[model samples]
Target: MWENLDRPPLDGRALTRALVDGPRGSWSRVDVVARTGSTNADLLAVADTAADRTALIADVQDAGRGRHSRSFTAPARSQVIVSALVKLPGVPPGSVGWLPLLTGVAVVDVLRTVAEVDAVLKWPNDVLVRGDESSGYAGGKVAGILVEVASTHPVVTAVSGVGINVSLTEAELPVPTATSLQLAGAAVIDRGTVVRAFLRAMGSALDEWRESGWDTAPIAELYRSRCDTLGRRVRVTMPGDTELVGVATDIDEHGRVVIVPESGDTSPVAVSAGDVTHLRALDA
Candidate 1:
């Protein structure tokens, strides 16, 4: 019996044990920390030595970061801040780009099924739900995924980080275009369950990807299915103030977003990295 002496954050012992107790278990271990600057940074620091499939979940993130080095922080204990180390010893470099997409799928699944919340994905890494978009914030951000590849020589290791707002109330939202599971009226708000589902889904997706010779078709198909970015007008902001306004068409095999731009370029532009803002609904 685990007793919370003083509003315990999460029971690491029980969570880790439950992660591997059932047949669907995918993680080797799940470690919970009271507070950390960033779970991704901590995992990446030891990814070289850490066992594959080890996950680090934090109850408090003081200096979390998101894509493009943007600072990401939330009220402590209100979000799920977690990271896992994945070792792709012989996987093709071409397939590494799918990590974030795969993570997005896992999250969407967990949100919809385990948490009973309708979730959508912004291209590349943002997790979104319907909300106000007037502030250049399309669909409220409910979660995010960040995948960092540490090496390629000896073995390829990627630290996949995920942050999901679980219990944050309306008043606690980081931004107007942001929300939490509670705000969305989730049927269940168990952080442990969400983390477990994410790990299992990711592990299953990774297996399918590797078994297919890093073939991205399966993941891409599924990702596209859940992606809200596709089939919508969008603005992709590149470095140096470059921008492309287009209709997100597809996620190409290489994991780049293929968009039919409103610009004169008839060919679909494949974007590998940039800030994406979903624009108004495409004309019917």
Candidate 2:
């Protein structure tokens, strides 16, 4: 149903109207850019001035970025790059840190509903396809999320950016371990449908976050149930010269990965920023 659109760089005005026409609580505003350096970069630059719940969708990004400055590549017509602006109220500065994880939950919900694939969250923020890891297939990194905070007068704006490999083919993937919807047998997907579903899911999540005192338990529970990182051997690389190798015990209340070392000592490490690598035991 959503495939009837002509192509990328779609008319923003028309798309916005169509999305709003569907439901009353959809995105407040939708702006489509033909091309940009990065939707996150563009949105963050004006987040302070933009109205809350505004979204930016881009067809192509010349400098699209992933967590830790990793390059995110997708063919101009095969990916979805979107950034939504959220304003949080009554949430402490420390507690607002879970926005990225919350956003990832919203994304995985939409992916499961539309694609009907068992998608799992990789701790902190990454989506993985279940069962793909054990079958010698690419199991990790189907999508990535980045949330940037901009604080100004009377408000803290979170710019949530998402990169989804929608219609990308196997040959177009940046790495062998990475896959797209098409490669995962979601060939009938329509980009607009995916975007609309994502926005709706995000709106619901944000509303609940604001109402629930930023209590991350509900979202965390959902994340943990769908997360593949828990109880796995992992190596977390920090920004400085610090690294931890342990078994992921649990996701703490603050969205930190709780790790237990091989020495039989339990230490809950709060990872605000880092790369988590899931390791396989030599015998496994």
Candidate 3:
């Protein structure tokens, strides 16, 4: 376990004490495993019985998946990989789509404060940092979030998986467009600390969301303020291999990215799910 001196194992007991046992904590349970295929899949497997607010972390994820089943893998202890089981009650079905966006907002806030990195959100739920021109790269994907519905028999439950690169070096990055906290010049790189802060931030955001009756206004405003894709020209690859190139104009009430096509139509299109590629920045 200690073969890599720099990449030490996570202290599960400490995490449980700080996040699950604290007075202001909202977690129902926290589990840390040495190796897992994917924490999100593990939680979904038990979604039928897993308690709400349950958090699962894996030191090494062999088959981590991003949006569209894109493989996201890293060296052991190289990232903060976790999944939280969230059960939403009294939330309207239409408003449920905001869960992932809300999660992104919470995570971006945590990264900005805890890691001390200039973090921002991209469209649906990607956390990114401003790229350094000297580094020969535009802003890279520092973290990616995947939200999957678990069940609806009794209530609306979903498993949200968030993977944040922490200690990966430039050569270790999964892709040239991917980056880690260390590579992003984070002030702190401790996995346990980052995980604890992320949980707290997420819990608080969920509480606010519920209190607002799943209202999208409050969170939407904040998300828009931090979103970098709002005024950029983007190419969205929709289902069926179709493509739409337009300017991202707004985030609708349903949390979809509102796009104004460059031509062929004047009406705006709202995209709920798709791959978004930022083409260029437009004048605000």
Q: Which candidate should be chosen as best, given lDDT against the real structure?
A: 3
Query: How well does model 2 score by local distance difference test?
Result: 0.78
Please give, for residues 71-114, the per-residue lDDT of candidate 1 as tens digits.
97776677888898988878888788888998898899888888
15-118: candidate 3 lDDT, tens digit per residue: 88888887866899999999999999999999989888999999999999998888878999999999999999877777777888988998899899999988
Writing each residue's lDDT as its tens digit, candidate 2 over 109-160 gives: 8888887767888888888766555555564467889888877347777899
TM-score of each: 0.91, 0.90, 0.95
Clashing pairs in 3: none
Error of 2 at 207 (Å): 1.3
Per-candidate local distance difference test? 0.83, 0.78, 0.90
Q: What's the true lDDT of residue 41 in model 2?
A: 91
CA RMSD (A), model 3: 2.1
* Lowest-sum lDDT 10-residue window in model 2: 1-10
RMSD values for the candidates in order, in angstroms, are 3.7, 3.2, 2.1
Identify the candidate with maximal TM-score.
3
- Pitting candidate 1 against candidate 2, the one with the higher TM-score is 1
TM-score ranking, best first: 3, 1, 2
lDDT of 3: 0.90
Q: Ten consecutive residues with minimal summed lDDT in candidate 1? A: 1-10
- The better candidate by lDDT, 1 or 3, is 3
